[model samples]
Structure formats: structure tokens, C-alpha cells
Target: MAAGDPNHVLHVARGIEPTEALAVLGAKPGLIRTCELPDSKPDEWTSLPCAALGIQPGTAAALLAGRIGEWTFVYDDLGFTCDDSATMALSADGRTAATSVFTINADASLLYAVGGEQVEWVNVDDLNLEEDLPGMPAELRAAFEAAGNVPTEDLEPGEADGDIGMRAACALAGLALTLEDVRRIPLLVVPFG
Candidate 1:
């Protein structure tokens, strides 16, 4: 995914706050910067260029785009247990939102999602058996287990393009019929923190 576009975005229809969803993903608070605007007004607040925040142009556009009530972002060491950090955004009503992690490469990316019918997430490489592991099906568990120790540093150019990570997430999210399936679902590509 591009620097500015969130690695994943979840549009919660009901029963959860955006902050609650972000917290579920292991995001903590500290030195984080934010931009808040009226819910019905997008341009009321002056937006910073994506480059200024070290984000992709597309990401900047999405975060700063129309009618969002609030937009907060930060990338700092906030006492997180993992080596991960991300730029996050939440709509004023705590429904629509997105997250982007700039430091992780394709090989080490972990995909996760929450606030839907199922709450699940998985490591594109090594998924934690102990966690809730949302959307994962019983049949695909063995496949992911068999592909253990998958390192992007060892793969061919196109082979490391988050295919495995995407597959695991799709299964966990119940969005795929097979490992090869590719649907346009929003995924949070969090690295091990």
C-alpha cells in the first residue's frame, strides 16, 4: 500500500468506537499529532502535505479529504510492546477509519481487522495461535502452519508482494474462497511490535 493510504481501513457500521478499534490493534498514545475538523467541513482545517508527514500522496489525500470531523496522526515510540508504529485516522463519529505503517516491509507485514462480524488478524508469515485470529477458517490453518518461517528476504521479486499475508488475512476475515483469492478488502498491515 502507498505511504499515505492506510494499510487498512475499517468502516464499522455499529457498536464500536474508532478509537476502540485502534486500541485493539495495539496502538498507544504519545507525542502523536492530530488534525481535527468539523464533521461536515473538510477544508475548514488546513491540511499538511503528505510529504511533510513522510506519507504517500494518496494517503494524504484520503486522510485529508472531504467531510471528516477529525483526523489524528502520529509515529513515535509510545511504550508499545512491539517494534511497530503507524499513522492512524478516525472519523468524528468513531465509525470510519484507517491505519498505515510505514516502517514494515512486505516480508514482515502482519494483517489485521476488527469491528465487523468477526474480529480477526494474522501474521502474513507467522500467525500467533494464541490470539483470537479473526475470520480464520479451520481448513486454512494447516496451510499457514505448513508455510512456517516464510521470510520475504528469501523470496523472488514478485513472490513477496504480500500475497501470503493477504491470503492469511482473507481467510481469517472470511473474505476468501481459496488462498489465491484477492478481494478488495481493507486490511491493517501491522508489523510485530
Candidate 2:
């Protein structure tokens, strides 16, 4: 998938490493294997042949992770890493932000946590309604509004409001990714049971 494609993006602050982030998300160290995918898109990594990778079919899980500036970004195809406990664990040292988009159902969510406490959680589609995002910081609220302002005509076929919201959240968390970046960067292909 491209940069803003439908997927879950998790950002952990304070320069956490990929392995460390995975640990915080509860991956067993012995089960985690790191590899490089020099030729595949981030989304394709999830469909990797488990047998060939020496992992059982039903037990395999995958995610792409990398550090950008002072934050670590984890790209989860299944969107499971955005749960409350995981977010709190990831933000224990600083902050964590997650964005999830499921285009099939038009479900999109953004979550933010700081110092192990959740601060904001909102549906991207409801961003325009102030009452929908209680306790959200002024800067983040502004970012969400700005991201929602893009004209529908300007977005690509599969892109939607959620993608824009994800980008805004990533930017605020000090991440800047593009299709090329996803392709060229040697992000750790973290596979685990």
C-alpha cells in the first residue's frame, strides 16, 4: 500500500527502536525475527509465506517498523497494536499516537496517549464536531481540522478522510512517509508468533 493507504500506523515518541516497540507491544523476544524487504511494499509483507519463513501459518504475525527522527513508527496490517493497553505501554516513556483506517467499512480512529495515559480518541469522520473529541489538545484539534479540509476531488481513488487524518497525526508526531520512503527504507520486517 501507499503512504496514506488504509492501515494502522502507530507512533511512539522518545526514539524507541523497532525491537523495543515490539516488546512494548508484547511480542516475545525469541519469536521475533527481523528481516529486510528491499523489493516489497509495506502491505505485501503481511502475506509472506509463513512456512518459508520457518513460522507456522496460524501463529505468524508481521509488522514493519522503523525510527524516524525522534519517534518510532510501527505499521500494522491488522490494526491490533492500537489497543489501550498497548498504547499505554508504548507511551510509558513519553507519548504514543495511533491511526487506523478500514476503508471497507469507513471506520477510522485516532488515539493519542502521553506518559502512559490516554489523552484523546476520536473517529476521523467525526473530527469536524468539537463535541466528538473531548480533551484533545488545541494543536492536534487544529491539525485534524486542517487535514479534513482537503478537497475530495484532490484525493486519489482509495484515499479518504482517514488517510488524511493519519498523515496529520504522523506529521504532528514527527513522521513523514511517502510511497517511495516505504519502498526504499529498510524498515525492520518484524515477524513473530
Candidate 3:
């Protein structure tokens, strides 16, 4: 803790915004900090350092290399691709009613398989349950509860892919796989906000 650091206790205990916490400590709003980016971009802003925004080297490369809109991102190495910013996410249960089975690759990369099917993510890391999942879609959670663990063979060949079945088996054994298990897991891990 420093004399000018935002009072973490006050911020957490009072449930006040970091800026307000800084105000209590008599720090400038501009100088007070948060790990999350500003929800809405400011109309007028000064260019900050690339390191300041804290983006991943790969993602920054995608932006700088002009591949932000292409299928050429590192995600290819992990085996699946997305044409759009994802509209839904899987719960830690690693299941989704979407068209693909999302899993994590050996290097902790993300992977996916597409086909209209009941999908569940997998982990090459271990057959363990995850302690945290960034988020889960409402539908995915609903479908998981409805389906339960009905055995992979019961899912059928056209029902889902093999990778999903393996992942589900691991989940059944209490493992938690992460999106990063697939290549290019969608997170800006470099730095910022």
C-alpha cells in the first residue's frame, strides 16, 4: 500500500467505484486505476501506449498485422475458428446447445468443432472440473441440466463429435477445462485499464 494508492479496503468494503475510492484518498480520477477497460470509449481520448492498454502479443499482432477480421489468427493451430465475436459462452460444465464443441488444446489452446449438435467442451489438460469459467450462456446451462450425464454413446454419432464426448467424460470425473485449453483463448492478457 502506498500513500496515494486507492484504498482497496474502502473500495471493496463500501462497494464504491474505484474512482470514488480514489476521491476519498484525494487522488486524481485520471490517476486512479482499474484492471478493466472503460466500458464505453471516450469521444475524445489521447493515444495511450500499446503496453498501457494491455493486449496480448498475439492479438496485438492480429491488430497490427491487419488480421483482426481474418481467419488467420492463431486459433487455426488449435483447430476451430469463429467468423464473429461469439454471441454465447459455455458454462464451466463445458456444455452448450450451440453448433460446436469447444475444448482446450494440449498447450492450453482453445479448440472447437461445428455441427448442429449438443456440445460440451473438453480438456486435454486433465479430467478435472474448472474452478472458474469466464461466463456461461443461459441456454447452455439450461441444456446441461436437462441432459445430465447420459453417457457419450447415447449422444449418437451425428449428435456430437468425439472430442466433446472425451471432454464430457473428463468433466464427469470432476475436471474443469478452460477456454485457454484451445489455442487463442479469447482474452487480452497483455495488460491495461
Which is the better candidate, 2 or 3, if ranked by TM-score? 2
Compute the lDDT for candidate 3. Answer: 0.25
Error of 3 at 149 (Å): 2.4
What tens-digit string does per-residue lDDT give for candidate 3 at 7-82? 1010010122223322332333454232322233222221111223443322321110001111111111111222
List the lowest-lDDT window of 10 residues for candidate 1.
179-188
Candidate models: Cα lDDT each: 0.30, 0.57, 0.25
**Residue 145 local lDDT, model 2:** 52
Highest-scoring model, lDDT: 2
Off by over 4 Å in 1: 4-18, 25-105, 109-162, 175-193
Q: Which stretches of candidate 2 lie over 4 Å from their true place?
A: 2-9, 38-60, 99-104, 129-135, 142-148, 153-160, 183-186
Per-residue alpha-carbon lDDT of model 2 for 6-96, expressed as tens digits?
3344444555677888788766677655555434433433333232244433354456667777677776554556567777777786655
Candidate 3 weakest lDDT stretch, 10 residues: 5-14
TM-score quality measure for candidate 1 = 0.28
Q: In angstroms, how far off is 126's CA in candidate 1?
A: 8.4
Q: How would you encode candidate 1's per-residue C-alpha lDDT over 1-193 as one tens digit per residue?
A: 1232223332221233334434544544331223332223223122232332344333222222111123222222111322222212122233322222223343334422222222233443444433423345553454344333344576543233344443343333333332122112122222213
TM-score order of candidates, top first? 2, 1, 3
Model 2, position 51: C-alpha lDDT score: 22
